[model samples]
Target: MWLNGLNLMDLLVKKLFSYPGRDFKSGRDTFAPFCKLDAKLNHPHSAYRTIHIGGTNGKGSVATKVAASLMREGHRVGLYTSPHIFDFRERIQINGQLISHEAVHRHLSHIFEEDTESLSFFSLLTAMAFLYFREERVDWAVIEVGLGGLYDATNVICPSACAITSIGWDHMEVLGNTLEEIARNKGAIAKSGVPFVAGPSAAPFFPQAIHVQRHNPYDLENQEIARAVLSTIGVHNPKGLKEKPPCRFEWRGDVLFDTAHNPEGFLRLLEALEYHFPGQKFYFAVAFSKGKDFQSCLDLIRPHAQGIFALRGDHEKLVKPEELNLPIEETLPEVRPLVVCGSFYIMNLKPKKGRETLGDWESDDGILSIQKRGE
Candidate 1:
């Protein structure tokens, strides 16, 4: 093996997973290491304004919309999200472009060279994104919280604005067993005197934040938050913001790709499904990662599903098909309007091609087309 650029990048990514990161157990003290790394990196995150988004659901959508809107307005925007579906580079992008493989290798080399101790996978990635954005001289960065907000590695930035899309009980083990705890953790992303925008339910958690007025369409509420965040930075007209990120109710012919892993997310997904296709029942292909309330999510859609196709996801923590107590199918159904739901890992599942094949389902670049904001 010559360890070419591509090989080096893959090796660095593999080494990143070996660190004591999100996959392993650690205390709040784990966050302290990031501070040292940031200092050594010269606080690259401070070079540009940041918009922080955290919530149980809709945070990624809101982040993407905000980034897209900024990008369309001619600003060099960097978007950082988590749990990439296919590519590790998807987690960091500037103006909808994935970070180059060489950039990843170069940054990883620097981090390893300067490191006195090991950093978490997320911490290293977060540092790499901050460094890349700063080096790229991006005008703005939209960062999405990977897990709970309070102690998440991405929370180290002092954002120009903060938004919490919605609060729900999902990560009870780490984020507390109640909604209040989760809300507080998510709301902790709010900076002092920095304009904080939150969805109606999440408003109570951020006492000083402005609440988005509830709207009929669930995504409208997410857009409202993005608009509010833009307003704080004097960018009033967020043009071209209507596009939804990949896997948020995305449709390929009749099969829907949705990352609705929790109960509340499923509720919103069901609402969107109902709004678009009235009086239509769907055949569901669902999978979920560990720590998610898969059963409750399933319960929400079970009544409306014509048949349930349990899919085993690619993650190690994925809930097995047998655990779902639903019929496991090795292939996709011939039924119209098949829905692939739950974890982002569902994108990894291989669906058998039928008569009506959804066109280019896996080719999503994860960037939405530019459209007029509020369209």
Candidate 2:
């Protein structure tokens, strides 16, 4: 991976995940693990202004944008996110750069030496991030919720602001079914005092079949969220938002990589596509997590998609292309300008030639540079 120095941090990152398995039944499980790890950060210096972002989709994007904007303002920023496309450290960054493996190992070793057995993979990793941020004395940190908000360990953040960027059907097993239910699950970051910024919603596509307790934060639309958050941050510039967090955009000649992960998210992504490359046929990389209703999401995207080319994410719950068994070949002959959407996992581009990213999780993996016609 083109990393320099510090083998210790790398070892720490890998070792941190020593405990396998997740009891994702609810937010409760998520907290317990973190609590166990938190008990170990003896220095206990958890002081830093935070920007906590949560949502089904776009949270990572918004978090990235927020961190970038903060960095542009010349603040020392720490960004912690999850499910890296490749490297584990992709999850933690300081001032716009990924932490070195050596640094990760050195930091993680301290926790390992203190208490070896209790921390879950997520918890251990989260602890490392907190330690690094504290040690570096960052001006601010952007923490992304790994799953739903309420119980997510990252929720430990006490921040200048909070953000929930769009909500929709996802993680049905934990968050519950229906948009409102899911939205509420994500909205938990809307604590009483912090400024909360939410992204736009496409409307509750589902009925009020599911009931969440009062004070559901997902109910706030993006505009309302923007107004609320702007007030807190003292930002009056909509002009700055015109560029719109590149959200998810990719390009390789005819093939475009758009990691549009869920169903409802297609609206804004498609809107972005129309603006960027109108009338292009899309060949997509589609997959659902264990909790996602794969076929339902597939059906929702089928019309807009030229054909679905399935792939997995680092989390490994993604559906494989062979498992899809859809009529992809037939659709491809007619579909122009193929797009690989839904997951970054599909960069391999299939056996057909030219859609390969030569590297693996390590940066040195060779990417399939280009595709020749009829190769």
Candidate 3:
């Protein structure tokens, strides 16, 4: 654990989560506290060039693709995303490498030493990523907005380029009830005179954006947005454009994993599935966070799924299987092409090592624990 049984990384995570406004779910009064914290840290985000991306969906994919393409172009790139699947360190990366545990301890420990009592979990993490990127001297950093843009912690930087991948019904409580309102919040990332690119759906909100035409198979649209975003940063033709952020239509054996927590995202994902595996009905395992329109999400899946298993996750915000009012399975059926979607937290379920089989999904101490390799 530690020299005296104190693991610094664990301590940091605990401390961060203990904050009053640890996440968007907790509700934030204002972004002032985050800005104050950033100022106190001497504004580390200002040290390097950044590309800020904000939207309801496809943002993570676009951000990851942009970072990967920049890396291929021989640039030292730093990528900051959110809601990590397995490890928290996945949120911060430099050239596709996760930030070292020691580095997280070093930066976050120092940040905690500051007067950060009012900062949220996302704010602290963003500051730490900015500090890490600055010290490491990355050529460019691709920053994804954790929520809506106007008041998001990552909105502190005036980036070299900005993009809004797509605007859909999500976080409507924090953002707004209408698409125009949501678009406005996400489009706020665009700075005056800075190069901006956006998908067609969100382009109307931002007058400055160079609109990209819509592409079927949602991932292709993400790729096009990434390409247009890269062109703004002087990268015309970069490689690795096909690489996706974790958990977006990711496949392990026959199980398909996706982080399509909202109705719009689920529609896109299902459409992609229809295109890829036409006329095939698949089993589904799904759960969603507290604030989401879970019913709408479920409605979209019901028609396409052969069978559906309601799941719960370790996170406090996740809806329990019983709450979903759907059949719960302790061990998934030996069904091929099981489409696991709804939330990123479902990714914690993994096949056991050696046996290489999906078996025995258990709930212990509020953790929807699934036994993995060597555990």
Candidate 4:
């Protein structure tokens, strides 16, 4: 079967990274070619109502909750997020199920046939999601912006409603150095007549936006944004939708796993840790990808940690543990309240046998293991 063909999948990955697309650099016109591709695909993105979420943090959590809540309300929901922890298929899901391997092969085959020589990995995936959602006849699709909303490939879809979770200094080189600049870029997703909801920093930019009050418990703030977005479409009762996307305060035994790669994310993680495990200290196992403010993140969380374990993962962009200038430990203790965090690459590494597994289990061997099992 096509799903069993490893060579085909390898070829797809190669083609995905071959284009000279902007990895980090941003321009408003950067995604114009992808917009053309979507048009060629017969505008599948227009076939369903969508919710577009953009922010420095909490966007993924808000998107997940919004999709799950809609699904609970008896809507066929399509969810699209970025930087999958293990499988590429995790980026596209319908009602919490990953897109099947056969479906990926079919969509990628079609994309290649359309001359996707200039499309970046994210652009290709976004187009594939539009096609999949339309063909599947979904009632709603929740899309999280991969980067700044203005130039993100997913911006091609005119969403039914829009939200900005929170504004912070991230991707500063591309989004700009100041909070106001970042807010402007993320707030660009707002449409004239569309209902918009935003956190405090971004609320001023959208005059018509309903401001979601920031709360002490970070998840509450995210829930407020999701609730507001759902209210726009008459979806009430968003409580008890407990679909936890991997690596966001996911727990196994005593260890917690989080993809807190930036300063803002780490601050939130620290708050969660303090709330959940009051007066308890954790041993933090952390790593960061390139272009992240790792030092600031570390400094903020250091006070709450008993010790720090520096992790070196397979991804090329990961900052080596030695480079951080912290005293690095070689292995984790058999039983300790640990927090595995920073880059998703660190979470992708195999945990020691004694460590409890939580959420999605990422293989140390790489994509082949998860792809073969079709997880």
Candidate 5:
């Protein structure tokens, strides 16, 4: 219910992002060298198993689903994600409950005693998660890579299972300009022994890196690719994951949300929906900032969507509504529902009467319905 951001949370964010210089050092070793500090960590006492998830988008969502399902399966699950919208503590969850602020401070304070002046904030937190998870003796801890995979601090975990959600162009300055370069960064999270499950697409972290579907034969567009990976590994039914928390096509009114900031990820989202749901009407919520390719993403997914909200969120990195509001296809045939897929911030407007999530599914208010002057 609290909407205001926290001062301490802001401080930690600034501190973690403080070391831009380190990200530029070496392409391959750029992110990993920081992990050497793990030698000093209390690894002997660490009892937490892990699942490392990486990708440009969908990493968080996929990790959330996996962690949630694990918790629902009676496992002691801890989910550590990033870039929280409402609260910083949302990043670290135990059995679906966020680690308390008191716990965060206690952990951070204890770790700060280690003379971390040279350590990035992310490195410290990764250590803290390991320490906390060890203390809690969690069955599994789901770790979402902060940026590129290999060098990311979270890669320190020796996870039992892992996944690369969907790779695309993001953090280009740190990861790389090309998708192949990016995929290499993320692929570092993949180990030789673990079953690496990937989304049905190439990622900028490893743009040129191809995943040959070593597990089972599944249609890439079906979005069952992920489900199949889970099943093949015996994690699906062995832990009672069948009936609870299924891989969903829609949420809260058949609305779909994918952090497909890159063209590749966007294409996959559109394709997966078209394959899984077919001609069913869809509501999309997309968020991106100024420097991103919002235009290309919109163009890629436009055909599959029956309605698009082009949402705007509360993040400072979000693109403004006026700037995102581009000229429409006035005479353009309605191949799909009329909608915009921009920032989610537009939801700040009070809901219209008689709609499900926000009501008033008409063209007057939501971004999908906004008509250009020529239209």
Candidate 6:
């Protein structure tokens, strides 16, 4: 569909992004507009039970795993994530299936009919997800926080269970400078009667919530957090997450792709790589956004990487690879095992050929389209 010489999706994107940046213009009432919009829609989020997941890292994985676990219990599950790698629909899914273009168009068109000028891009999408999930009659919706928890747009919902996977240093500019400050901000999603779960690292911040102990491999710790969240909601002995989320230490052939953009995430990724591939040093291709502590990430990857290839993409937020004083590469190395890690935008540097299709797990659109629009 075309609207005034623009693809319908493009038109919608423009409208949604008009309110740029994470904060609303009137900072006094951050979530008031979202709450009013939800009330007007008869509070669609209340139509289904929700589990809110928040953290600096691993919240997406935890949300996916929690949704997958709920599915194992014979429930129709809706998973809402953020920062889509390919298509916007990837951020909203039901039973591992991306929301259809028709559904996005329908819900967004309806949403645009209202006074939505005050909403942020994430808030609009979160509203769309609530409406879609309600109409689809989902048994449960796993909502992932787009940013800090307290004032985040997704915090409008009163969830049955809330979990924060880990507390890290990313988003310090908005969340806080210290780990405790960050954890408190993310932990604010915990309501009086709602069950709250925290990973081993985030446990100290929320002594009232159920605390998950650390596991050896980083992946195991995430799985443990998911399992604990499920148990609180009466889904005991549920079958765990079958597969990892897209771009979370995902491997296509001998090439590994991970979106570990922050220092804490980098530490975990490197530790996992060492544990999984002992005595094997792999080549690295890396890029990062401007605000991230890329030096810390690079320092972590240096010892484990046999060779490093700094890559730059067209995204406005990405730091120039050459600025790091490393060898910049137009193409990834043809080594036996090459690891590509950093910002989500770096995925643009990946070749389409020889790439492993997500096999119905992802939308068919290319990353170039989203990146071109600076999404």
What is candidate 3's TM-score against the reference? 0.90
Q: Encode model 4's per-residue lDDT on 129-239: one tens digit a residue.
A: 999999899999999998898888888889999999888888899999988889888888888888899876567766678998777557767777888888988887785
In model 1, the Cα lDDT at residue 269 comes to 84
Q: Residue 375 deviation, candidate 5, in Å? A: 35
List per-candidate RMSD values in Å: 2.6, 7.4, 5.5, 4.5, 9.0, 4.8
Any runs in candidate 5 off by more than 4 Å, and if so which?
Answer: 1-37, 44-46, 118-121, 202-258, 272-287, 301-314, 325-375
lDDT of each: 0.80, 0.59, 0.81, 0.79, 0.55, 0.81
Instruction: Give the CA lDDT, 0 to 100, for residue 174 in model 2.
Output: 82
lDDT of 6 by residue, 1-375 (tens): 336523786677777767655672343265888888888888999999999999888998889888888987889999899888666778898887778777887888899988887777888899999999999999999999988888888888999999989898988877778988888788888999899998988988889989999875677788889989999999878675544577777766667878899988998888888788777898998888888898889898888888888886787878988888898876665665788888888764555456543223343542111110000
Tens digit of per-residue lDDT, candidate 3, span 135-237 = 8999999999988988888998989999998888998887888999888888878899999898977877776689999887888898899999999878898
User: Against the hidden reference, what TM-scores do the models get?
Assistant: 0.92, 0.76, 0.90, 0.90, 0.67, 0.90
- Residue pairs in steric clash, candidate 1? 240-371, 240-373
- Top candidate, metric TM-score: 1
Judged by whole-model lDDT over C-alpha atoms, candidate 6 comes out at 0.81
Sliding window of 10 residues with minimal summed lDDT for model 1: 366-375
Mind giving the per-residue lDDT tens digits that candidate 5 earns over 1-375? 543446665555566456442334453453344455565556612476777878776666556656656766678977787754334555666775666655676676566555565555556666777777776889888788887777777877787777786666766777778878887878888887777776655432333333434211112222333453345445664332221111122222323323345675566556655565567655454556666777888777667655444444455667764565743222212233323234333323322344343333232221111111110
* Candidate 3 weakest lDDT stretch, 10 residues: 366-375
Clashes of each: 2, 22, 0, 0, 34, 0
